[model samples]
Target: MALDSLVSNFFWSNSDGSGKIHWAAWKNYRNLKTREVGTGHYIDVFKDPWVPAAKQFRIPVNNDISVNQDMVVADLVQERSWNLQPINRKIDKLYLDLISKIPLTSSPRADKLMWAPARDGTYSVKAGYRAKTSAIEGRTGVTRASPSKKVDTRIWRRCASNPVCPVCGDETESLEHLFLLCNWVKVAWFGYSMGIYISPRNIKNLGFWLEEFQLLNDSDFDYSKAYVASMLWAIWKLRCRMTFEQVEPSPSEAMEMTNRAMKEYWEVNSLFPKAPTFAEPEASYKWRKLQSHTLKLNCDDAFCKKNGKGGIGIVCRDSEGLFIKGWAEQVSAYSAFHTEMLAICKAVQLVEEWGMQSVIIEMDCQDLYKAVTQCSFRHCPWSLHGLLIEITDPVQNRSLVSFSLIPREGNSTADRLAALA
Candidate 1:
């Protein structure tokens, strides 16, 4: 309201290049603001983005017909309902269903401008910049998704210096050629993008490419769209680096980058997300005895970052530190800490198998220790529920059972056994 009081809907008007610093941002605001139709007065039906989910939030215009900028949404209404006559006469039937579905009123309540991207109709500079960064339906051969559109300077780059494809150096680098038809881009889509096997058609239109590309993700895991977007972004960056900077574009680089990002994303969102870093106690490393009757089970796990395989090792000993039983096995695991939890689970199985009482399980994972011992996992992520429940259920059932953290040096024997697995 204060901004409106200052400039009187500056968001809707073009501030001419009068050396204003906010000109680029000022231009982006009009495109993203939608209209919430109450009275529909002052809401330009042809220009405003009022139709929900319509392409660019506006109805598809017939290029043959000249558009009147003065045409407001009120012009299409008759008796609290959308009159199809004026709409069909003007914008055509492309978004007639979407238009009719919109909630309107016959009363004189003023139309409200809304920031379309946000759930709540408010705007911040961060949201404004985000909207601007994603506005690429390929008006230019550039995208903000690239590494720092700032590019060692604040000078605004509209397009690359060369129109030719920097990677192939054969054809003009349009958005279609760069993303869909580029030889390098094709390799990335097939190799890095979950082996998307859509055969290349000689399609020049990106819209047609998107329509066909939707079929690439048919798996139970719904990560295809984000994965595909990441691939496209990587390819865009590769081309940008090659064109703007002196860096050579590598097809493998783009594919690998996309693959790495998607892999990390999958890890985070998957059942076994990456664990937070935990600090160990700052004391000299030594195994401690609780009681003479208590059987100390030292558990540790080894995870190969190179491969996804994990090794669980558990060693049971008397209070005197003499090993009574040792067990090791290889299995699939999600993270290093994940394997730690698995090791504890296996130790619990050993406890039940051996049918022992007065047991203490020790592990090298401090975070897991704190999470299991101090925190109730009921409110934690479901990713940890299955494993935490497995380890903690026995603890609840058995009064003598407990868990504690040990230093890496104190857990060296179990570590060795795990490595052998």
Candidate 2:
């Protein structure tokens, strides 16, 4: 069947036009000339998109044509060969050449429809949309170029009232300045680059800078591209925030936002299997036997910044190292440290509810360890002050309860559970 006919039939049969919005959308999308024919059995030879030179094969208007409206390209083929005598006499040489070059099989099959812009002869919505956009851009004399150039053109044309950088409040806002040269953007890029251990090169051209990273021989080259793209997007968003909302994010906050955005992009776009979480060497940290008659609780927290939520896992084991009871819960939190503090607090509440006289709480966060050991909120961020108070209360009320820090490898089970939760 012809692709358009198939689509039209599907929509017409499935839809009731009670709401005209959906029907209008379907009709608009169906009208887009995005499909080409293969084998040419189902498509109209003169009316449908069958020839490559033009969207449809054009018939000479001055010449008297005797073909039926229902006729297809197959009617022009006989005995597994093109009946080119009549076609050559009717159409121009360019289209005739396109039709003549089409390969024919001894055993013919039904014609198929394929996306014209796709390499694999398969359909892709993205490719079709891009082709449509390119056509529109071509007609307007606007070509795909660097965003900086587009912005500069707009500024020159006085399309924008002000062209200054919103984040830095200095320098004309071009793509280069927004992404790399502005002081605020520079700080964000520096922090992201340092965290990933990839030094920023002193390249000014945005295209060359991006291309250089993409051409690197390192295994993380794609990840590097994602990081750069994320930073660029974050910088744009920061500019928008400043311009529209009149709010500025700190450099650290901007970097964090960029990292979280990159993580989300990877999760949605990744095709490879997820890499295993790295663990410290087993020899570096081993689980120790709990003191006699005391229960040991291993707690861990997994925070997903995209959702502003976290998972907590707490597993209690007897002094002999056998599992007693385990619990996992989801909680709201702003940061990893906050989640860790909440997990510790949950562990304490569980211990107190069980009426365990002597219990040891172990976790994998060194910051949380220091906060508890120092008995001071100096090391804790202000966001965790209230949770820290709640956490310390349970510890102080129970004379035998204590907090300890263990390496992540030693807390593998709890970590796995937290991830699952």
Candidate 3:
């Protein structure tokens, strides 16, 4: 009821009746999706915010118009496929391509409104409040607004305090001074890259500096921002330590801490799983060639916790080590071992379907290899015992099919395919 009232009030207050609300309040909430598109029934083709590619369906020319305000997206569809002729004439080629890609169900249902802020299309008051507060902090360029408000050094000093920065002890304490101008911060940021320099004269504000940094290093923007944010956090920690604990903080130590923190943050929040950390392969490690008229299958799996999904990659090579064919598929799996087992099972299925003779299946997973070879699941968990049994069936039926364990280095092609999937 409260949510409905809040939404009603917002729509009523807006003069244009457009559902566009200022998102500055939720800009700091990194997880917010912000953009939404629903099935096109009531949405105005030219005026409404249903077209994600262009953000809105606006005609480029001032004196000319393409689509009518009353026209909805459903009007552009005839049967299941898009009526491209009218749509192409109305919108630009880029937007037309994007629209064509939008999947439509065979049995179309009523247009449903969706919340863009959350993955499940549901909003929470707690998330909304946190996003709003985070936005405030970002605008003010402060770590914590409450602490800054409560601890007014001027009030305690009984006079106008100079507010010298704890790090450099030379400049006034401000967002710029604390994050950018401080000697310690400069050392921490510029120490690794002497080529990159932050000039105070060019930087109008901390936000502007961060934006410019992102533009300059577009490819590595995420990692660069993460590193910079970690550095700022470390600098703030150092400042707090100096003021409260009367401890002198080393710039090197702070940089080291920032590196560790960034690593942990990447591990936890990254969209893709980190590559397995393995030691250097032995000098003898290499892809072994198969016997005459024999085919070799190299299989690998990649699991990403962010999406709770996994990918299976299998490559077939002849006795001469020549590439034959490869297959990659995205699958749902709980664990890496499970994904590996699935990949092995998929390989067996492919071999059976292809009617291949004298095939050798190679994989890097040691546990899966042992399970397949031993064919004993007395000690294996109930969950994996069935999978193990299924994997061993092909070997038992087809005497020509064999399983082998290989080092990850020898399975580079499959590994690459899995990661790409």
Candidate 4:
């Protein structure tokens, strides 16, 4: 690379803080160099010396010198001098991609990459998901019949003498046995990880596995992919520690380390502002079509905590806030949110029965509101069982219905009816 090009790509400040150089200024200064150095000099003297070294080394071997000096030079290049700027840039781009586009709810891939859903680019949650999945997969496989077909006298010999399997100890271990089968991996997974497990099939590769798990699972999945991935990373770190430092941590100690790592990851990744929750194109289109309407229906419900009695209320008002007529019904229900949703269902049914069009539905529950308007809440028991049931017949035609949220104070009529119920 030309000195001018290098100068153009980076900003520099003087030691005394008295001067600064933009890439353009630095590049111009470099171009003023009276003598030009060869590419070899640039790589050996400037690039290798300045750039941080990468884990993988790319040292050029030269046979120009006697053995001793040449070996020393090769060793230094391999051990410390290789430039890592390219790999660092790649990692940064990966983190950026995670924050800008990937959804948080994905399961981790085997390669240790997961789509981090937060506004910030952090991998704590991803690690948690991966570790949990790996542990579970490990446990599952261990509990099942061994894949190895050979029956051994070792297996039948006094099982008590070998309390711990030569392959796996009493830790309920399997996949960890295959990839990370050891006391260290078990301590991290079983001890720190709250006993959650993910199927091994989801893990793709070491670099991006956790990330794949995060990608594969949705946000509402039982296991939090981010949390699992964090655990996996911590386990890997512990492995490195054991290998290099000759230190072995007990299960409790490893759990503490896992917590600390997860905490730090969350702090770095979550402090930044989150991106706006994006709506799918089809959802956005449907939302726009419904919002184009004029009349809005606001519904609510209130239940007595002591008993299951509740009241359902629905009010139809124009955009200007004038009442178009409203209805309040008292009912009995164990679930208050269910009752609230029932009101919307009934209101929608009533509107359709009356042949009314262009209605906007308002509710206090966000989940219920989204469920009703999007027709995507079918999975929610109450939203599906109660809310959907009420509007099923009514929504069959050309009417537009939307859902929104209003302050509790804005729902005086519903409040009064609920009090009565």
Candidate 5:
């Protein structure tokens, strides 16, 4: 196709249509490409295809008064950088973000046309088929309602640009580097109990390693396939935040989102099994008595449904039922479980601060009691993981801590204090 003279000038000729029936189909795809700018001197600003971050490898027209069609890319270049003064108010915010991401070259060279779909700029028939298939079915396996009008933007960015890992400044971003090797991902993996340590040498490749981990879901292991899917989705969301919204990447935020994703999957799955969901479990109304030498600490959360505010109350008493120390305050919380967790952490902090040797922690929330006492936090709510980690950390050896569940009536003193706060 490159050796024919008529086909060489076929894309740019607008006046010739006699032999354009098949040529137009080729020209339509030819426009869906980009050129690597060298000096930015010859490329047309709007007419020519550039900016692979946008649709069709070109910028979209926005409804603005400062539209300029008679300009080249050189008009917006100053001191080897993009001069936003000429086009800041001329484009939409979404398109402006895409334009700013396009890197500029300082050294003088010829403008090179690039095939944006392939990893390398040069095109092949195999790459064309993969690109067309990705357009129909998404690269990340998300189901789309309308494939033609809506695009899988995450896959689009992956194809258009070669970017480094934003969380860790790695030189290259591959599947191995993105999921397994990055330091930020290591911290996230540690969020689960005992953690997963991946040994690359023992496995053949990434596929074999993931398949081995996935098979453990059906075994007696606590780790499940839902967590694997959640991790992949969370990592993709982190990349999207940096790519589209320009938000800073956060490891804690990523873990929280992963927990939320797993929770959503469990909730939907529970519907089929007909598992009963309850605000509080049916428990014995009696309160267990503590040892005469031990101190008892009671904590409760008073959450306001209207304003989403919460009151935390902590009361400590001796085995004789004599009040020793009481703390109450109003604070902001994400959910009722989160508020209860925050109060528990505060109670533990008070125990450590007071130098109490032996104490029994009591609460009205049965779900949290089981989560804390059983040493299993994999199925906890989204925001409670961090607090659970904190509560589980300081109690390793300093204080003898035992969790107990009580009815709302038995813990009325702490409940009243929480309401008063």
Candidate 6:
């Protein structure tokens, strides 16, 4: 009744009758509270009512104004319950976006979120290694095991304290440092940032580059983000190469790796049901055989498996297998195959620069070849055809241009050279 000074141990105090309510009153209380109470005993709060005179809160018989059991304090408390609706509202939308991006809904997207220990009192990291000897393939998604623990390390640097770049140790080892700041990485980043196919010569600070990254527009953001992610992934991969795999990728090799990664992610994600492939269905083109003195420059471009770095390889071989000349040029660009076709047009400029005459130019890229060979056509990136024609117009009469597909294997040498580019 006295709310402020209500004894918490009143039930225990009433055990020997030193409290406000008694044991005999409990039965009456229980009977009164019984209908409203859903389950469980409610009279455990009180014990005995026979104690010394110093402890009596009330006399039992005469003052019975009968307390209402319905108003019992504990009975007034509601059951604690959980509703998943609000949680679902927040998570369901996020999950839908996630599933839309990553269709395989079951895979764990976050490393820290899904990690669990094994039954053997050890982490699954060890269990995954042991699974290699079991009747199961260890690395696939079916194995229910992750890649080796070393692969999941957060900090990749050897010098963690006051750390500097591994490539050029002049700057601190951080994301911006390793990516946009370090001399070695900055050059490659700049090569991607600038329109140069070649990496930059020097990188002094990351702050300077961060400014550039912040200033990039939406299109530039996509390009720069892909470039940065690819380059970072490549750097991590190259570190794995040297540390775990005992193989190291050269700067150029690493740059190419970055290109391939970005390209692959784009192409693979583009193929999704929701995200339709942006590439046009390539049209076919007819080729006209040209004279030997008039070199047919068959230029093919390939983006690597990761980044979209442009590699253009040109084969100037005659009708015979005897090699005339080949040129492989690596361009730092995030554009897709159509841009590769544009690079071929750029290669025509290179050919003209070499002072070659009566050229029969060919490409494995059908859409680009068709667009270049024809005067009128409609295609996505339709404006490019005009640029293609304009680039080739000078040599159209003096030289002929054609497009055809050689087997991918036959094109290997050129492909390899292009990949190197």
| Most accurate candidate by lDDT | 1
The whole-model lDDT of each prediction reads: 0.71, 0.69, 0.69, 0.48, 0.69, 0.47
- Cα lDDT tens digits for candidate 5, 1-421: 5658676566345554232322224464675477766666778877887765567767666655757887778788788677867878777776665555344544344566777776446667766655655654664575543452234334544563766766677645555556666777667767654377655465334465677877765684434677877887897788777778878766687788888987888787778876577778665465446687799899998987655578999999987778999999886664687678878888888887998878988898888887777655543542234356567667766647777887787788898998889
Error of 1 at 146 (Å): 15
Clashing pairs in 3: none
Can you list the residue pairs that collide in candidate 5?
A: none
TM-scores of all models? Answer: 0.37, 0.37, 0.37, 0.30, 0.34, 0.29
| Candidate 4 residue runs with Cα over 4 Å from true position | 1-293, 377-379, 382-387
In the range 1-421, model 6's lDDT, one tens digit per residue, is: 5864466455345454243333332232221111111111232112222111112211122223433333221332234111223223323343322212111111112111111112212224344334333423433435332343224223444434446545565655665455454455545645554532323344333445445554764566876767666787886677556655656436676678887888898898789778455988555343345555656666667775354456878777665545788888765433455446655766677666877655656556666555565643443232233344545465466535444544445455666777777
Candidate number with the higher lDDT (1 or 5): 1
| Model 4, global lDDT | 0.48
Error of 3 at 272 (Å): 40
Q: Candidate 2's residue-wise lDDT over 319-378, tens digit each? A: 988999999998766568777887898888898798888988999888788888676666
Better of 2 and 4 by TM-score: 2
Which parts of model 2 are misplaced by more than 4 Å? 1-284
Compose the digit string of candidate 3's lDDT tens values, residues 266-361.
Answer: 878777776898998575666566689999999999998665578989999999999999999987664687688879988988998988999999
Q: How big is the positional error of residue 207 in model 4, measured in Å on the Cα after superposition?
A: 40
User: 119 in model 2: Cα distance from truth in Å?
Assistant: 54
Model 6 Cα displacement at 256 (Å)?
A: 51
lDDT of 1 by residue, 123-207 (tens): 7766775675566434556643334323422232236566777778888766667786777777767776366644546564566
